[model samples]
Target: MPRLADIDEISSLVLFVASDDAGYSTGVEFVADGGNLLGPVPAAKS
Candidate 1:
């Protein structure tokens, strides 16, 4: 199972994005998943 991200970790990202520091940031997608989409190493075979 993939380890879930801590609330603090996600919160920090949100805060950064909402802050003035991220003013120049645009057209971005923040993938907060803990590599869950990757599944097992080498990936699963059909």
Candidate 2:
């Protein structure tokens, strides 16, 4: 997704972390950058 993420998308993650569902989760990262860390996509071959 090259475009910016929706508010609900990021909020959902935050909700999960705050909820008991994420009780066991620790020492981890929660990335919400829409694959930006993967770098730009390569151009398609001709």
Candidate 3:
């Protein structure tokens, strides 16, 4: 099952981008889709 992202999870990314730590990061696409972009995970074989 896919897990949903918590508010804190997304907020942390936002906080980092707003902070000086991400100062050099420009024109970057920050994806916070909880690995959804990687496609669905295959089911385990029994």
Ranking by lDDT: 2, 3, 1
Which is superior by lDDT, 1 or 3?
Answer: 3
Best by TM-score: 2
Best candidate, lDDT: 2
Better of 1 and 2 by lDDT: 2
Q: Write the per-residue lDDT of candidate 2 for residues 1-46, one digit (tens) a residue.
A: 6899999999999999999999889877999999999999998899
TM-score for every candidate vs. truth? 0.69, 0.87, 0.86
Superposed by TM-score, candidate 2 places the C-alpha of residue 19 at a distance from the truth, in angstroms, of 0.6
lDDT of 3 by residue, 1-46 (tens): 2889999999999999999999899889999998898898998899
Of models 2 and 3, which has the larger lDDT? 2
Q: Candidate 1 vs. truth: CA RMSD?
A: 4.2
Looking at candidate 3, what is the lDDT of residue 23? Answer: 87
Query: Residue by residue across 1-46, what tens digits does model 1's lDDT show?
Result: 4677889999999999999998888878877787777777676799
Backbone atom clashes (below 3 Å) for every candidate: 0, 0, 0
